[model samples]
Target chain A: MTNSIRAEWTKFRTVRGWVIGLLTAIPLTVLIGLLGPLGSSFDCAGPNGAQCRGNTPPIGPDGTPVFDTFYFVHRTLTGDGSVTARVGALRDAEPWAKAGLLLKEGTTSGSRYAAVLLTGGHGVRMQYDFTEDIAGPSPDEDRQWLRLTREGTTLTGETSSDGRRWSTVGTVRLDFGERVELGMFVSSPQHLETSNTFGGRLDRGAPTVATTSFDQVRTTGAAAEDWRGTAVGIDPAREHEVGFTDDGGDLTITGTGDIAPIPASAGSLGKTAENALVGAFAGLVAVLVVAALFATSEYRRGIIRTSFTANPRRGQLLAAKAVVVGGLSFVVGAVSSALALPLVERAELAEGFFQHPTTWLTELRLVLGTGLLFAVAAVLAVALGMFLRRGALTVTAVVVGVVLPYLLAVASVLPTGPAEVLVTVTPAAAFAIQQSVEEYPQVAASYTPADGYFPLSPTGGLVVLCGYAAVAVVLAAIATRRRDA
Target chain B: MSALHAEWTKAWTVPGTAWLLAGVVTLTPLLGVLAASSMAEGGDPARTSLLGVTLGQAAVVGLAVATVSGEYGTGMIRTTLTAVPRRLAVLRAKAFLVCMLTVAGGTAAVGASVAAGDALLPEGLSIAQGPVLRAAVGSVLYLALVGLLGVGVAALVRDAATAVGLVLGLLFLTPIVASLVSDPDWRERLLEWSPMTAGLAVQATVDLGSQPIGPWQGLGVLAAWASAALLAGAAALRLRDAS
Candidate 1:
C-alpha cells in the first residue's frame, strides 16, 4: 500500500495535465465569485429621493417606471384624458384625502391626482385607474384599475374596495434595473359653463352627489429568502401590502440588507465549499478517464504481459494506479481550494464580511469537504476504469454517470410534484449545497407568508443529494469489483 | 479511397465513437427540447430553446477528444503510422473525420433543438427572425469548433481523460474563473477570450449591444483556440515517439 502510494505520487507529479488542471481552479473560482457582486448595485430608493440623485430614475425617459425597480403611480392622466365615473357622480367638493385633490359640487372638469410611491426601492406596486365607468348597476362589474408591485422582475396588479378586500386584475414585468410608476387622473368632458354629474342627484341646495375614496395604500419590500410557506398572493399588486406573520421556524424572511453576501454567509461558504467539492469530483472523472486509458493502452499495445512479468500481482498494479490518481485529485482539490479561499474571501470582504466565527468554520468545512468529494471521485473513477479495462467504455460510462443525472434534473418532463423532488435529488441537489439561501425554489416549492404553499425542508434536500452520491459510488464500486480487468 | 475506407472503418469499429455520436444526437436535442419547454412554460422561449447548446458543446468537446485520444489510448496510432507513414496525413484524416462527424451531429442537435423550441415556445418567439436563425446556425458551428478544440487537446495530452479534462477545463474553467474575479474589466476581457464564453457568444439573441464580444468575433476567437491547439498537437505528435 505504501509502495503504491509513493509510486502514485511520483506519477501524479510527473503528469503535466494534472498539474495544469489543478492549478486552473484557483483563477476560475475567483473569476466567477467576483462577477456575482460586480454585475449591478441595488438602490432601495426610487425616482423622487436622495438615493436617485443624478442617477437615472428607475423609470424610462417617458416617465414610465421600469418593471423591477419600484412601484410607480401617476394619479394624473397623460395625452387626451377624461375621467368617466362608473358608480359615482363627480362634484366640486372640498378636499377629503391627504396627498390628493378633491372634487366639489357643480364641477365641470374632471379631478386629476398622481402619486408615486417607491417602496424604499424594494418591492413593487400595482396601478389602479378608477376612471373606467362600470356600465351595470352591479358592484362586482368589471372596472379598470391600475395597480403594480414587483418581486424580482415579476409585477402584479390588483383593485380593491375600501382598500381592504382586493381582487387581482393582471400581472406583467418591465426590464431589470428600471423604475416603475402609476398615474391617476379624473376629467369631465363637459364645457366649463356646464356641470356634469355621476352617481347621486346634484342640487344647488345640497352637496354634490359623487364621491370616490382611495385609502389603505401601502407597499412592503418583498422578502429575499426562498419562497417556502409564504403566501404568494394572486393579486400581484396587493401582495406588497400583505405583511408577514410568523408561523413555525420553517418560514422566515431574512431581509436583503441583513443577509451577508455568498462568501461571507455561513450558508454561502458551505455552498461554495460544496461547489469546490463537486468541481473536484468532476476533476476526478477526468483522472479516472485518463487512468483507464493508461491501463488499457498497455493492454492494447500487448504490454500488459510484460507489466505482469515485472509485477505479477494484478491487484498491485491496479492499486498503484488508484493511489496515483486519487492522490493527484486530492492534492489538486486541496491546492485549488486553498488558493481560491483568499481571493474569494477578499471579494466577500469587499462586499462586507460576516463577523461571526461560525461563518469561518463553515467556510473551512466546505473547503475540506470538497477535498474529500474529489478524493472519492478519484477512487471511484480508477476502480471503474480498472474494472471496465476498455478505455472507450470506461470513459463513456464515467461521463454518462457524471453528466446524465444533471441533465435529467434540468429536464422538466416529469410531473411537477415528482419532478421537483427528482430534480432536487440529482446533481441539482448536490449543487444546492452551494446555495446560501435557506429555501431554494429549484429544489422545493416556495411560498410567501401571506400566500399559502408548502415546500421541502433544507435538511430533506441535503439527504437527497447525499443519497445520489452514495448510490453512484456504490454502483461504481460494485461494477468495479465484479468486472474483469 | 481505401485509406478513407480504412479510417472510416477504424473510427466506427470503436464503440466509444458510436456511443459518443449517439450521445451527441440524443442528448443535445433532448436538452434543447427540455429547455425550450421549461422556458415556454415560464414565458421566455429563446433562453430555454438554446440551453441544450450549453451542455451539447461539452459533449462535442468530448467527442473531439476521443477522436485522437482513443487511438493514443489503445496504441493504434503506431499501426496507422505504419500504414500511412506520413504523420501529417493521419492528423489531417483524423481532423477531417472528426470535424465532419461533429458538424453533422451538431447540425442535427441544433436543428432538433430549434425545431423543438419552435414547437414548444410560447406565442411570442418567432424562428423566422434573421438574427435568431443566425444564432441557431452559429450554435451548430460553435459545437463543431469545440469538437476541434477537443481533438487538439487530445493530441497534445495523448491521454483520453487528461485531454478531456484539459479541454473541458479550458472551455469551462476560464468562464467560471472570470465570473469569480472581482474586477469588471478583467472579467470582461476573460469573457471575451475564454473559449467557451467566446463560443457561446453566438447564442445571444436579446441584447447584442451588451455582449463582451460580438457574435461572429466570438466564434472566430474559439476557432483561433482550436487552430492553435491543433497546431501545437500536430507539432507534439511530429516530435514524439509513437509509444
Candidate 2:
C-alpha cells in the first residue's frame, strides 16, 4: 500500500496538467466563494422589508401636492353650537386625489381630532371623540375627522390611538373614478332671540388644531393594465400569480399559468443565483467523461501491460491513475469556481451587498469544498474504469452512478424509500452544500433550520458536503481494491 | 467486408459493450423518471425529469471514451492496426460502429426518459407539450453527440485516464468559467460559445429569449466540437507510429 501510494504520488507530481489543475482550483474556489457575500446586504428591515416604508402619502391626480404641509396649530374663536369644515379636491384635477391629512386638537376648542384624509372612488370616514361627557341636558356633539388613502379604485381607512400601532377601521368601494371632495360643517338650530351668549363663550373664538405627520402619499398607483385582445388572461382560473407590482406592470404568471410571488429579499436572490448555478453545473458530466477517457486511454493503446510492468501492483497503477484524474478535476473545479465568484458576487451585489465577517468563511467552504467534490467524482471515475477493465464499461458505470440517482429522484416509483435515500446520498448531497436556504426536509435529515430561520446556515451545508465527499472517496477506494484494472 | 465482420464480432463478443449499452438504455430514463418524480413532488416536474439528462450524458461520454480508450489500455490497438493497415479506415470503422451503437442506445435511453418522465411527472406536466417533446428528443441527440465527442477525445489522448479527463474538462470547464465570471457580457459569451453550455441550451423550456445561444445553434456547437476532435484524432493516428 505504501509503495502504491508512493508510486501514485510520483506519477501525480510529474504530470504538468496536475500541477496546473491544482493552481487553478485554489483561486477559482476563492472567487466562487466570494459571490454570495458580494450579492447580499444588511437591510434595516429584516428579510422582506416589513418595517422599511409601509405606505406612501396620497397625491392629487395631476401629480401636485394635495395638502401644502402638515402642521399643528392652536387658536380660540367664538362660535355657535355647531361648526363646519369643508374639504374638496382642487380644480382641474384629473379624477382622484391621494394624500394623508391629519387634524389634531389645539388649546382653544379643548377638543382633539386624530384622523387621516383621503379621496378616491372608494372612500371611508373614521373619527373618534376625545372629550369627557356631561351627565344630562347636554346637546349631542358631533366632530368630523378625515382619514383615508386611495390606490386605484381601492380606498383604505386607518385609525391609531398611540401613533405606533395602526389598524384598518373600514374599507369602502365606490364607482367614483373621478374627482371628489371632503370637509366638515357645523350648525346651530337656536335663533338669536331665544337666548343671549354667555360671557366666556361670546368672547372666545373657534378651536384650532394642527397636523402631526404625513408621508408616502401618491395618486399614480391606481391604473391597472388593460389585457384586452391579448392571448394571455389576466386572472385566469388556472394561472398562478407570481408577482404584482404597481411600479412596473400588472401581475404576471408563468406561461403555464402557475405563479408564486417571489419574496423581496437578498435571501431569495441568493437562492435564485444558486439555482442558476445548479442548472449550469449540471453539464459537468461532459467534463467527467473527458477525464475518464484520459484515464482509460492507455488501455486502447495496449499500454496497460507497460503501465502494470512499470508499477508491478495493479492497485498502484489504479491509484496513480486516480490521483492524476482527481488532481485534474480539482484544478478544473477550482478554476470554474474562481471564474463564477465574480459573476455570482456581482449578481448578489446587484440585489444589495452586505458585509458580513462570516462571509469569508462561507466563501472558503464553497470553493475548497466544491473542488474536493469534483476530485472525488474523478476518483470514482478511475475506480469504475479499473473495475470494468474496459473503457466503455467503466464510463457507463461511472455515468450511471453519477446521473442515475438524479433521475431516480424524479422517477415516480410506488415506494419512494430507495429513490429518496439514493438521491439524498448522491450528487443531491453535493447540491445541498450549495444551499443558502434551510436544507430541504425530505432530502436532508440532520440539517434543519432554526425557528423562524430564513436561509440555509452556511456551516451546516459544508458539513453535508464533507459527508458526500467522504462517501464518494470510500466507495472509490473499495471499488479500486475489489476490481481488476 | 471481412475486417468489418471481424470488428463487429469483436465488439459484440465483449461483455462490457453489451453491459454498457444496457446500462445506457435502462439507467438514462430511469434516473430521469426518478428526478422528475422527486421534482414533481415539490417543484417543476419537467425540469426535474430532465435532470437525469445531465448525468446520463456523462455516462454516454464515458461509454464513448471507453470504447476507444479500452483498446488502447489493453494494448490491442497495435494488433488491430496490423490487421487493418489503413489507419483512417480503422478510425472510420470504429466511428461508424460506435455511432450506430450510440444512436441505438441513445434512442432507447431518450425514449425511456420521455416515457418515464411522462409517467412519473405530476398531472400538470404534459410530455405531449411542444417544449417537453423538444427536450426529450434533443436529449437523445445530445447523448449521441456526447458519445462521438468521447470517441474523438479518446483517439487524440490515447490514454484512457487522460482522455476522459480532457474531454470532461473541455465539456464542463466553460460553464464553470461562465458562472464564476463577474461580467454579464463575458459570461454570456462564454455560455454561448462553450460546447456543453451551448448544447445543453436545448434542454431549456423556459425563457428561450434569455438563452445565450439558440437551441439548434447550441447543438451545432457540440457537433463542431465532435468534428474537430475527430479530425484531430484522425490526424494523430495517421501521423504517429502504433505502439
Per residue, candidate 1 scores C-alpha lDDT tens digits across A390-416 of 565555455544444333332212223
DockQ of each: 0.17, 0.17
Which portions of model 2 miss their true places by more than 4 Å? A1-8, A14-359, A363-425, A431-485, B1-3, B35-51, B117-139, B172-192, B197-218
Task: Report model 2's TM-score to 2 decimal places.
Answer: 0.52
How big is the positional error of residue A267 in model 1, measured in Å on the Cα after superposition? Answer: 17
lDDT (10s digit) by residue, model 2, range A1-485: 65656655665567565455445544444443443343233343644545422211122222211122122211121111111122232222211222223222221122233234332222323322211111111111121123345444444455443334545654444333343222121111111111111000011222111111122222222222231111121223322321112223211111111001111122222233343243224334544554455455455555666776776656566666666667767767655664565565465545443211124455655556556667766676666555544555554455445544433332122123444466455543454444433322111111211111222243443344455445545565566556454
TM-score: which candidate is best? 1
Please give me the total number of clashing residue pairs in predicted model 2: 111
Q: Ten consecutive residues with minimal summed lDDT in candidate 1 chain B? A: B38-47
Chain B TM-score, structure 2: 0.89
**TM-score versus the correct structure, for each prediction:** 0.57, 0.52
